[model samples]
Target: MLKWQWRQGIVTLFFVAVGLLLAILVGYSQPAFRSADSGSLSARSGVKIEYPVAEIKTGLPLPSDRTEVQMAAACLPPQRTPTALSFQAKLVTPEPSRAVPKYKPQQRQEKVHPTNYGNRMQRDVHHRRVNNELLVVLHETVGDAHGAISTFQTPHYDDDNQVSYHAVISRNGTVIYLVPANKRAYGAGNSEFIGINGVEAVQTNPSLASSVNNFAYHISLETPVDGLLDDHPEHSGYTQKQYQSLAWLIARTGVATSRITTHAAIDREGARQDPRSFSFPKLLSYLNQYPRPTEIPPCPLPPQG
Candidate 1:
């Protein structure tokens, strides 16, 4: 019975040692681990160990600190340079203005001035043609001599090489010869003699048609005047010498004093007012003093038309 009691006592001591070890392990799990060399209470208990209870880190090779591992994961890796984006801005622009055309009118050229009236008149033909039925056409040159000559020399006025005005009176009472007494002068364009022949209804008073009728020998008288119808110096009338010369030429032409019509008188515009400052009464009186032997008839008044 004593031997059985000893065995029981030994088994009881083994169970107590196991319980103490389990209690020490529970205490270690509760407190933070201290160094083995620190002489901790756990180390003195003979149940504590220096080795780690569990592994501190897993995956990613992170440290025991969670804060450090999170900072490392947040850090980004280096990247390639970014491509440049297109920055074009669309803008509405106005179209260019169209060119405008300029309108211009065409120009007309001026006509040429006539040169010679009768440059081709032969001497025989000019002298042989004597116009007995005299129809004198008197002309008074108002402008300069150059203009007068130019007018008389124009071909339009003297076509057929037979332009003949018996005489031309200059401003200074100078008489110019265009043709001799024997040729038909183209002095009158659309005209007729009133005294001797042609229509009597067209007949004007002898004194009125005297200037034109005096061309019996186919001659013309050129008279000069200081003024025309207006009778102003600006109108350019005849000088006293020119009037006297005209009278002399009339007397020489043997024109009856009764038949001197101005261009206006025969043309019948009622606008025919010439010898504006001249006295017809005085001229008649002078003519009365120098009478022609032929019996003078009453002058028929010019037709109004």
Candidate 2:
């Protein structure tokens, strides 16, 4: 009976030892199972697991907070760049004037002379084709609009006596078209436009120096009675109406602001400086109202004789 009792106790001890071994094995495998389950759950939830469980167990350092933020930002949609058209949309539109008159072409034979202007030459005396780009040349008639018009009307057979402009704007904002746009008015004598493409001018007459008239659209603003003196530095500045009309006229031409220059700037003879007391900023303010035309209108053919 004692031997049997001892055998039973040994069996009981063996069972307990086997149970402990099984428990230890399960405990050792539990952490791995939990890690795999966590990874699966993160993937299912669309969470990015930057460091693998193996990496963490190997004691590798985790990414910094900033690195995590950068990663998050990288996942976001890209931002759009501001385009030129978008920027232009934000520009302020100028106030409408009280009396915005329509552009009128003066057809009177006295006002419109036949020989004062010529065709926009395709090539200069050097045989080089002038740039197709047109420049807006601002001028101030050194006298009243009527006087300027009269001067243009008078016949001048001599080349040196030739002087005209494409149009003239009175103080009341009356725009009188004199010479056709396709014709080169005798606007700038002994002048040149130093632009991005270098010196720009054409010598239509070998006797005269190169001039910007060949590729220039001349617009003359009638000088104030006070500004009639050539020596005067400035005068009672141009009227608001004049500024508005000038801006309106130029905006339609599709000529860029950079190319809009003064006769004073282009004149090489050093004797010309008519546009006195003009405010460029004021003109630009009004110009901003109009969107730049997509295409510049082709110059109409000159009236057939």
* lDDT of model number 1: 0.37
TM-score of 2: 0.60
How many steric clashes between backbone atoms does each model show?
23, 0
**How close is every model to the real structure, measured as TM-score?**
0.39, 0.60
Per-residue lDDT of candidate 2, residues 74-181 (tens digit): 232221111111222112323344443354322222356776888777677878654446788999998888999998998889998999998898888877888876
Q: lDDT tens string, model 1, 133-175?
A: 2233455444444454555555563233323354655556565
Give the Cα lDDT of each candidate. 0.37, 0.67
The candidate scoring highest on lDDT is 2
User: Looking at model 2, which ten-residue stretch has the lowest summed lDDT?
Assistant: 80-89
Locate the minimum summed-lDDT window of 10 residues in model 1. 80-89
